[model samples]
Every structure is written in structure tokens, then in C-alpha cells.
Target: MDRKKNISMAVIKRIPKYYRYLKELAENDVDRISSNELSEKIGFTASQIRQDLNCFGDFGQQGYGYNVKELLAQISSILGLDKEYNTIIIGAGNIGQAIANYTYFQRMSFDLKAIFDINPKLIGLRIRDVSIEDIDNLESFIKNNEVDIAIICVPKERAQGVCDIITSSGIKAIWNFAPVDLKVPNDVIVENVHLSESLMTLSYLLNESKITE
Candidate 1:
């Protein structure tokens, strides 16, 4: 596994929260930022920000603080957003098509390169600006274009098989939205996104808070 990819996967998950704070700082014209200040803004402790920043090599001065521009650049590089990543989404169902039409990644540093489905009806259809491609074309497309990541939105039963095919096609990273947990080789990185789990967590928090009132 590429160490850069490993570090990036961890840091990319934090970009939104960090970016929000940085954007506020930029609006306020705050130049130098201590880790503590960054922490307060993001609801993390100053030491946590310092430690996370240290993972990509020191960016903050011992006494002063981190230069906003420098720190932003470092975080950007670590998250692998300095360059664009071409992504393929498997399964052209509702969620998949929704993701295809989403403008969030286009506004950020990622691009939705293609979509795949086994249904012949969907094979020729277009989602967003990108057209849906048959699963049979996945290997050729990935090989020819050098796709960086894949999104697995297929049914839980088919998720593992799709991931296997993706790995064989040379994609190293995956964003799996299936309900089941997937097993992959060490060389492949699978990020499982269980929306139900998140919603349940939120529900639990709200219920707990309500009891305290």
C-alpha cells in the first residue's frame, strides 16, 4: 500500500471539518493559527490538531503558529486533493445515479469518471453528464483511464463480487455503500459507508439527550 494513500485516506476524512474552520479563518483574515486555536474552531483540542498536522511533518512554529496558507497546502497534499482522482461508481440504481448527479465532488478535487451496472437497460443510459457503462466494460475502462477509486453501491449480496472484480481490474481504493462488510486483500483499501449505522447513532444521541431534559 502507498503510505501516501494511507495517510491521505485518514486525512481526507477530516478535510470538510478542517476546511470549514479554515474558510472561517480566511474570512476573518486570520493569518497565523495555533493548533489550539484551530482546535477551538473545529471542536477539537489544540493538541489533537498539532498531532494530526505532525503526521505530515511539522507545519507549525514552536512558539508562533502555523501559517494558514502553508498548513492548507500541507493538508491538501496529504488528502491527495492537490491532484484530481478519477472515480468509477458501480451499480446504477437510485443511490448511484444520485451520486452521479451530485455536484459536491465536482466542486471539490474529485471527479466521477464513470458508472457501471449489469442491467442492459441502464447500460446505454446517461446519469449526470457521465453515461452508464456495462460492467463488462469496467476492466477495459479502468485499465485505459487509470481510475483511482471505485464506489460500490450494489446490493449487499453482490457487493463482494463487485469488489473482487474491481480489485482484479487494478483499482486500489473503494468507497463501499453496501450493508454487508467486505473483505479485501491488503493491497486494496475498502471504505465501508453504512448510512443506517450513522442514522442509528444520531437517533441514539437524540433519544439520550431528550431523556436528560
Candidate 2:
């Protein structure tokens, strides 16, 4: 199998925990580790880890294990954290401002390049060095710039429309924080982060705990 196609986001997401555990092992001078050992430390079944790794071809020997440093580098590159990605923000609201303020976004190789909104008051404003432009300028700006990702922070009612505009603007991936479900084209990737649902889940957990008590 093609190595790039073998490593997926599902497997990539688990790499951090695995890398942390491997780092600990490396600190102890453990040069190699078995699948079973990784499974034990990360609470995954040995077979599952093996299956994920199999996508990238067999990295372990029968009795020996994987090289910690090599596996870490492989996983890091797969997650795309090894290079910087230029990002744009749709909506210059409070939530959008907060995302712009996030240092981890830059630390993780995501650079905030610009912001967009329909509000005339916000248009031409600057936040964190990225000027807020009129939403009408989205297509031209995105086309001329190197924006690879869009962060949607618009109101729930406007989410879908805004997303459609963003997709039309040629952004392939979106990190959406709007309350509404976005309907974009098939080629576009939309990741919704519903804050209300998360809060409701916490509320349900608190209620369930009270019942048990």
C-alpha cells in the first residue's frame, strides 16, 4: 500500500499519546518496543495498534519492537504539523478573535493570514495583525493568497451561507464553530465544533452523577 494513504487522521490522532508514552520509554533508554507494550500503555488492544501500523507496512520485528524516534517522526509528518499552513478566518466576531489569539495555532504550524466578515463596522479592522476584510472580497483574496484552511465562526443562521461562500472561495478545509450544520460541496471538508452540544453533554453528566449520588 502507498505509505501516505496508509496513515490516516484516525491513526494520526492517536499518535500524540503514543508518542508521549514512547518518549517516556526512550527516556528510560528503551530503544525498541513491542505492539503489546504500546497497547498496554495506551489502553488499546495489541491487534488494533498492529492494524493501524499495518497500513504503513510492518514496522516491528517478531520478537523486537519499533524504533521510538523513527515512529515519532513518521507520525508527526503524517499529521501535517511538520509544515506551516496558511489559514483564513470567516467572521470577525468574538469567537473568531479568540481563535486568532490562540498561540497553539501558530505553534502547531497554522498561521492566521486574514479575517472576513459582512459587518461594515468590522471591515478594514485589524486583529492580531490580520486585517478583517469584507466578505465580498473572499473569493479574490483567497485566490490571490495562500490560504489552505478557513475557520467559520459566523452565527448559526448564517453558517451554511458563509460556508458556501468559503467553499466557492476555494478553501478545501474548514474548522467550523457555528451552531448550525453546514451544507458544503462534496469536495470540501467541514469539521463542526458544536459548543452547545458539548455544554449539554456536561450538563447531562452532572445530572446523571446527582441521580447516582
Top candidate by lDDT: 2
- Ten-residue stretch with the least lDDT total in model 2: 1-10
Q: Per-residue lDDT tens digits of candidate 1, residues 1-213?
A: 112324555555676677667766777888888887777778877877776666567578988998887666666675677898899999999788877888888777679988999999999888778989999888888888979889999998999999888888889999989988888888998888899899999999999999998
Q: Which residue segments of model 1 deviate by more than 4 Å? A: 1-16, 27-29, 209-213
**What overall lDDT, based on C-alpha atoms, would model 1 receive against the true structure?**
0.82
**lDDT of model 1 at residue 186?**
88
- Please count the clashing residue pairs in each candidate, in the order shown: 0, 0
The Cα local distance difference test for each model comes to 0.82, 0.83
TM-score of 1: 0.84
**Clashing pairs for predicted structure model 1, backbone only:** none
Best-fitting candidate, scored by TM-score = 1
